[model samples]
Target: MDTLSFNHTALTAPNRTVEVGGRRLAYRRFGHGPNLVLCVRFRGTMDSWDPLFLDLLARDFTVNVFDYSGLGLSTGKPSYVKTDMAQDVDDLVTALGLGKVAIAGWSIGGIAAQVFAALHPEKVSHVLAIGTMPPGLMVKPSAPLFLQTAFKPENGIEDQYILFFEPDSARSRAAGDASVARIASRSMVVDAITPPAVMIQSVIESADPTTPFPDPDGRYQAFYRSTDIPVLALSGDHDIMFPVENWYAMNDLWPTLFVVTWPDSGHGPQHQYPELSADLIASFVKNNPRPV
Candidate 1:
């Protein structure tokens, strides 16, 4: 297959909607090659992606970024359970006729990706988890309390600074600003933020102490161990939310996992270093061939 040339202009392309499993899903598909499905972070919309980052990935793969049901323009009840969200992704993939795709997820989306891979192992060629906590591990919040406050729906800019950019690093802050600007260039029209009730429910469900992995081992180690699918885990060294230590812990369990950490970045490493992050993901997929 001929790889599509990276097009910066596509970053501002409009999104379309498709019905999946009786609910409408808002999505944008660009570039061409092997399919790559991106699951967004908590309370994120399809427009939330950084243009430069998406453009880079689009150079080598058909990238599909979509909003979860009930978020953005998608219509349905929101799901708090990671597994349920994963199923939604599966439904969308099936609806689009995207066969055996490479999957990447950020933050809570990473958790959903893992579940999706586990539940539908035959459908995934590879898995990439970014700025995610270890599966089934309920750790204390790595970010400051004020950072949580900054995540309020009305505080979009501040939320980006606190959640995505490294606080003390001017360079990282500038990158965050640039990403926000790039997103803005796509459209001044912003979708309604995910409802606080849904967001709170998701947070509570994800962090519930009594609920770990479904298996007896209390972790997803068995699932990772048994699967031959390549897994790449990436995070920011300075990430205040789900810190790099979380990746380290996950790596400790799955020794075969490929891991990387961006220096001086926070929760959103891709936003801080779009070029490098895109290169890393594209390279990983190229290097790890799917089984014949």
Candidate 2:
């Protein structure tokens, strides 16, 4: 099934495209087992994810990661609207003939994942949200440094340390550096880095999706609450961008939800501990199968 990757790992996987709704979605797929579609963060391309994390996930599942419409390699009217992102996911999945697949998203992409699950419950089996806040209200505000660092045209190891890792912890900082290096170690990069203009618009113009499905009182509350699908959110205890506390406050709200926060870590816990994160995700997906 995988003609591009010889070892079934994300690192060596070649680029591919699938046309959907007039949009050419750029994607890469490797490994074996059930399908897992991953969505990247703000200003992130398909090349943005750490290969260590992706390769680890590939061990247990067929991993699919892609660029959003008009970002990176995807061709379409560029937008950061949550509904448009959800549409991208739905169109790409249907175009690729992937049915009932598990979905994972990081940062703002997590919001896109929630929207997708709420709108297309039949197409999704499990939802894995990494380093993202729950919908509605945030228990605490995000760190100002996040906006400062994210708006940069290019990020170096130091910027990454500030954005994704706990600078106070030498261990966490080192882990962040290693993760960044691994992502750059790719011999072939299929996706383009998102430019500064796109980054600014993506963050500023992003909109949350409203539920078209019914909820309690015949009105919408939280999108995740509208679906019975099992949702797992992975985060760092010290995530400056999206605090894990917000997720805890809404723990009792969602019908089926789980959270995992790694200590001394920041926004990208999956990157800091790729193997452990991947293993936990594999166990979660294997244990929770969507009702047929």
Candidate 3:
């Protein structure tokens, strides 16, 4: 395989499409190394990813980012169920002919990634989850009022700042500003945005898991605890949407899960501290080689 220079400009990266489960799945493949799939955040399109972060990850591994079945340029009906979404990811992986890939999931994508790992353990070598809540856990209503308002779709940039940056720190605010600018640099048009209906449905699906919210049956908890795949859970200490406490809950349930929390950061630590986040991810992968 030939190595290509990491493109700082995400829009310039060539967009490719593949047929998966009778739907057209759009994706961008860049960087070089063992295959690593990136599952994007809630309502995030293929272009919404931060180029700097992607570039950093691409430096060490071949990164694959794509649109969900009905989101962005992809074609099909969008299902909000995490298990179904996980199947979609598996279909795409098989469609692309990738063998034994690693995966990093952000926010809701993290939930889907967990499901994927549980369902198809043989196909996944490692898992990286960021700004995510544990499966079947009901989210506590502890977000600050400002952060709550920020969750609205119309809030836009201000919402991003509230959700992803530490409001009390100037440095954190600046990092948030730069990350947003990098996302805009992708030159995404309105058509590229995920539909409001789809976003709402996805959010609902995330909160209401198949096993039940709060995992009253304990089945969801058992599923994750049973998985022996190497897992790394990353978070921002100041995260508002999915607070740092969420990571603690996950750790409490699965004592073996590795956890990393960045100081003075919020929901999107990978964007706020791209270099550190990327280095941690690379090191984790390096340290935990797949069993032969």
Best by lDDT: 2
Cα-based lDDT for every prediction:
0.77, 0.83, 0.77
TM-score of each: 0.88, 0.92, 0.88
Report the C-alpha lDDT of model 2 over 1-292, residue by residue, as the tens digit.
Answer: 7556436577778788898888799999988888999988888888889998998898888899998998888888777777788899999899988988899999988878877887788899999999987766576878889879988888788889888889899999889879988988988656776677876776566643432111324222455665678899999999988989988986888878898989999999999999899999999999987666
- Please list the residue runs of candidate 2 whose C-alpha ends up more than 4 Å from where it truly belongs after superposition: 2-7, 207-223
What are the root-mean-square deviations of the candidates from the true structure over C-alphas? 3.1, 3.1, 3.0
lDDT of 3 by residue, 1-292 (tens): 7334254234556777898678899888888888889888777778767889888888788888888888888888776567777887898899988888888888778877877887788899898988777766545534666435645766566677777778678899899889988877765422266767677675665555343224466666787786667789898887776776766767766844889999998888899999999999999898887566
Runs of candidate 1 exceeding 4 Å displacement:
1-10, 138-141, 144-147, 188-198, 201-219
- Evaluate model 1: give its TM-score: 0.88
- Count of clashes in candidate 3: 0
lDDT of 1 at 24: 89
